[model samples]
Target: MDAAVAEAHVAALQGEDAHAAEPFRMSAVKFAMWLFLASEVMFFAGLLGSYLVLRFSHANQFSEEALALNWPLATLNTVVLIGSSLTMALAVSAAQAGQAPRTARFLGFTFVLGVVFLVVKAIEYSTKIHHGIVPSMSLFYASYFTMTGCHALHLIGGLVPVTVVGLRALRGRVDGGKVELVGLYWHFVDLVWIFLFPLLYLI
Candidate 1:
């Protein structure tokens, strides 16, 4: 064959193979995740907005009700959550590097930290309830519980996928893209808590 025809043939074969690749590629998955996160952003935005409106509307009562929260426990949970985010990032890095064992270990650590955060939050909730600071007691209490409760639910939901990913990593079945998607979600959860911690506990 002539040199020009030979080059064209090779290029055509490469194009065909590329076109025949998997339909559900990593880019598709990442795009879907971005869309999902966008919706979650709006949902959380509404919740935070409601909480802020309530807080500012009843500033005096809100301050008094905020005094009922266990700042020490909340602060501790914040630290645990931030630590978990770090571990989650490391897990993604390991997955990308194709180190399945390391990925699994980091993911397991992240899961444990998530559990610790929930435990501390549960303790704080019980303490507040014991002090008669239930949601119905005041607007601040209501906003606080609703915001944190939704967050806790998200954390619980996130744990399931994290556990599954970690198990898959142990079996050397997880791909880097899946790990990246999960990491995005985990980071979002941690970021929400970062905002909530100071908003509810400190400020």
Candidate 2:
């Protein structure tokens, strides 16, 4: 009877161990990404809040300075970013479907669109600089450069992961989870620009 009890106890422990070893319902990497994004949301909220305070206090100055921004160019860049988001979605779908080549193709498209966005932004920056419009020139220009520069940096950081995942996909090693995580980040970056474009250019 003692031997039988020992065997049953060992079985119970083994079952518990197996249960503990099961994967999380949500992946660890995905959870980490969500946490990171949450922090980013708070960071941007602070920036926008500060900008709004300054903008309202200096309404006429802001309105006058906003005119210097090239809304048409910004609008074009918005469309390009939106297109990149669509391609990123397609890449995620392809990865989920285990279509590695298709995933790579879509990732390449997304990368190109992202590059186009940066190039247009660079042109806008050059024009502003040529006209002596810079961050130190005014509060409005300072906010504009700070917000857009941070967003651009995020996009540049995201491209590295996209390229890595795309290369792996090309080698028939597509990870849907990684692709989805990257998509989450890319979409967030695009969404920020969506808010920023209208706020700085149209508003």
Candidate 3:
């Protein structure tokens, strides 16, 4: 059979129809993306729950403590994150369209943005510490550490995959929906920060 016909037939398969043909077997990659995203949902839920607990239980302390946070720095990081998300989306689009070089370029830009975010976060963390707002000092500081630290780690985690994808794009190796998948994950990381900024930093 022609490749197009075979691909069309396989693409049309659903549920048990997939088992009818070898080429129509359900995809491990697709399954993994869903499973990974489910786990990510749980992870973010836990973080948000922690934030809520700390916010309401010690509302006055948290609010008072939050007064010292640098809004200018947080706002700058927010713009950086949103920009990275845009680059990520473009990389995904380029990859889907088989423009490997463009995909690599955009992915590289996204990775650089991630690095810049981490740097800014490090600066923020340093400044906070210098001001003696250590986690041991207040419930708010502890929650801030736990929540923002986890998010920083997540941003770091996002860095690795974006770099990997960019490298693969350079080598002309990655394809399919891999770019889109990374784009989704990276966008989610950015989205999480978006919610976190106003809630934790501005509020």
In angstroms, give how far residue 122 of model 2 lies from its true place: 0.3
User: Which residue pairs collide in model 2, if any?
Assistant: none
Best by TM-score: 2
Q: Return the clash pairs for model 1, or none.
A: none
The TM-score that candidate 1 achieves is 0.85
Worst 10 residues of 3 by lDDT: 17-26
> What are the runs in model 3 whose C-alpha is more than 4 Å off?
1-26
What is the lDDT, from 0 to 100, of the residue 53 in candidate 1?
87
lDDT for residue 112 in candidate 3, whole number 0-100: 96
lDDT of 3 at 121: 95
Worst 10 residues of 2 by lDDT: 16-25
lDDT of each: 0.88, 0.92, 0.86
Alpha-carbon lDDT of model 1: 0.88
Provide the clashing-pair count of each candidate structure: 0, 0, 0
Backbone clash tally (model 2) = 0
Sorted on TM-score, best first, the list reads 2, 1, 3
Per residue, candidate 3 scores C-alpha lDDT tens digits across 1-203 of 69999787878675576666566344678667767878987898888888888788888888877877888899999999999999998898899899999999999999999999999999999988888878898778887888899899989988888988899999987684888878878988898899888988888
lDDT of 2 at 22: 48
